[model samples]
Target: MSDLYIGLMSGTSLDGVDGVLVDFSSVQPRVLSHATQGFDDRFRAELLQLNTSGPDELHRAALAANELARVYALVVKRLLETTGTQPAQVRAVGAHGQTVRHRPQQFDGTGYTLQLNQPGLLAELCGMDVVADFRSRDVAAGGQGAPLVPPFHQALFGQLPGVTAVLNIGGISNLSLLNASGAGSLIGFDCGPGNALMDAWSQTHTRQAFDAEGRWAAAGTVHAGLLQSLLSEPFLALPAPKSTGRDLFNGPWLQAHLQSFAHVSAQDVQATLTELTAQACADSLLKQAPDCKRLIVCGGGALNTHLMSRLRALLPGCDVASSAVHGLPPLQVEATAFAWLARQCLERQTGSVQSVTGARGARILGAIYPA
Candidate 1:
């Protein structure tokens, strides 16, 4: 029997899915292989539209969920083919379906989050046991069903003495701090905007999906006015146990911040947004985990060269680097995390800590769909 689990992650950016075949046969699990599968243009647009109020809500979301499963099935096929592994040999798949809405605080009750996925479809399509819906349980338990990767960071970086922080710069930025083998204070929360605002601006101006290595931002100067205004967002001051997404920091939100600075150039806005992300992350790390020695960045934002420079500039004396510096590629860490989460669920282990998500307590996350 192969103790293998595949993790499929499509982050808040509405980006493609990242699939990783993970082997937990040893003390430290290993990513046997990693592959990325893209969503078609229609599906991407559909998901983006679903982010806000739209027509035909029930029908559209259901269609999008089914489509998400189809795309995920493609990822599974690619992962198994590339690794020469059979679906039957794999244990389970941890599918963090695309998160459309992550509102952990609702007026009526604790709160809720929704990830567009069809695990039953995935299990049927991929011929493997599927584990997904990893966030709802934490929310049901009165926790912000966000920043689910911190424990994985703790497990991965736990043995490295001193305070170690893992910053995942996806659509939104989140910080996961671990003090070496659970030795000290652990903190995890969404820092602020990562690529979402920047990408939206880039797409609007350049017609490109992203700002390729943060080149545009590097070419521009950070407008202090805009940066200050952006920094003034209330989410930043709320302290830990808080999380946010594009719902609050999208393009319109950025535009609202920029309205006062009409003369600011587009590139400058990009630069300021980039600064916003770096500053929020750095400030949170310095304040929350003062003794943090090593900062490892993962997600698509880590690949942004200029963003890395900004982080290093803000965080002097802290060895700022990508997750690749440690071993796992920046893009693969989250997907691999889901794979580990699947293992946790199957073993009845708690995947989240109360301190991180403000959950009532640790609980096994994700729903299992038998093959």
Candidate 2:
């Protein structure tokens, strides 16, 4: 009686689309198959531009959403093929569409978060029910409408006796501190830049998408003064139960901080960005979960060797390791969490934690589409 769900995620990184097939019957959802499809450079550029452009940007967003829907359909088809699961056998697909504009609070007092996913079109194309629009409900409930993975973390890895910090380093980084009582109490927030700064710096310098295992960063020295300046960002000091995305950690932010550092070596900047992520993450964890001895790292940043080494240096007493060490692959954890959220949607269960998202109370997240 296991249900198969396809969870599609396009994160803050705007790198690509990750579609995961998961089986939800037991405590831990089983990942059946996964596929990642990279977005074309043209689409990426358009997306980046739309993030800051004016009302005319809506046209670009529409184009991007159409393109993304096609990619989602393709990924769903490939996932079904790879898993040997027919479309009829699958319950539904959870589509976390591309987040174009997430203005949780507007100057006009209208709070809205936009995740540009044409779920109806996706459902029509994929021939399956699509659950999307997951963030609006939480915002309506007076929540931050982000860092929605903590409840999933609790479901997947909350067995330890003491506080455990689950750090997810996607384009943005967020941490969830799970109290040891096994009562599912948690606190979470976006720590500052993760791979976003490093990736932007690398691309600006070497035309590379990323540092690749943080090799380029490992070759350089961390600029301590620059790192401190980066750390001084107001967002880093923001209290918990908060969240952020590329809106805060994009190229312009980096450039503003660059100042005279434009003369610095690209490698040095890369190293400093790496250190920034590690330090910001560790600082957040230490402040919130001072007694936490176990830090579980997940997402793309977990694979960055240089970043991991820096994190290990910053948190000397904590046992820092990838979620893979605890049975979850770094790259697939977020996708899998979305799959779990899909399961929650199906069961009419709450997928968000009030303690994490500042929601008034727990509520079932996402709008469902019948197959």
The per-model lDDT (C-alpha) reads 0.90, 0.85
Model 1: worst 10 consecutive residues (lDDT sum): 178-187
Predicted candidate 1 versus true structure: per-residue lDDT over 204-268, tens digit per residue: 88988889999999999999988899999998988889998878888678778778999999898
lDDT of 2: 0.85
Judging by lDDT against the true structure, name the best candidate. 1
TM-score (C-alpha, index-matched) for candidate 1: 0.98
User: What are the clashing pairs of model 1?
Assistant: 158-181
Q: Taking the tens digit of each residue's C-alpha lDDT, what string does model 2 give over 1-371?
A: 45888889988777899889988866678888989999888887777777776777777688778889999999998998887788888888999888767666555444778887788889889888889888889888888788888888877788876888899999889998887435667777789788877887788889998899999999999887788878889989988777787778888888888895767787898898898999999999888877789999998899999899889998999999999999878888888888778878888999888887787898899998776
Worst 10 residues of 2 by lDDT: 101-110
Error of 1 at 209 (Å): 0.7
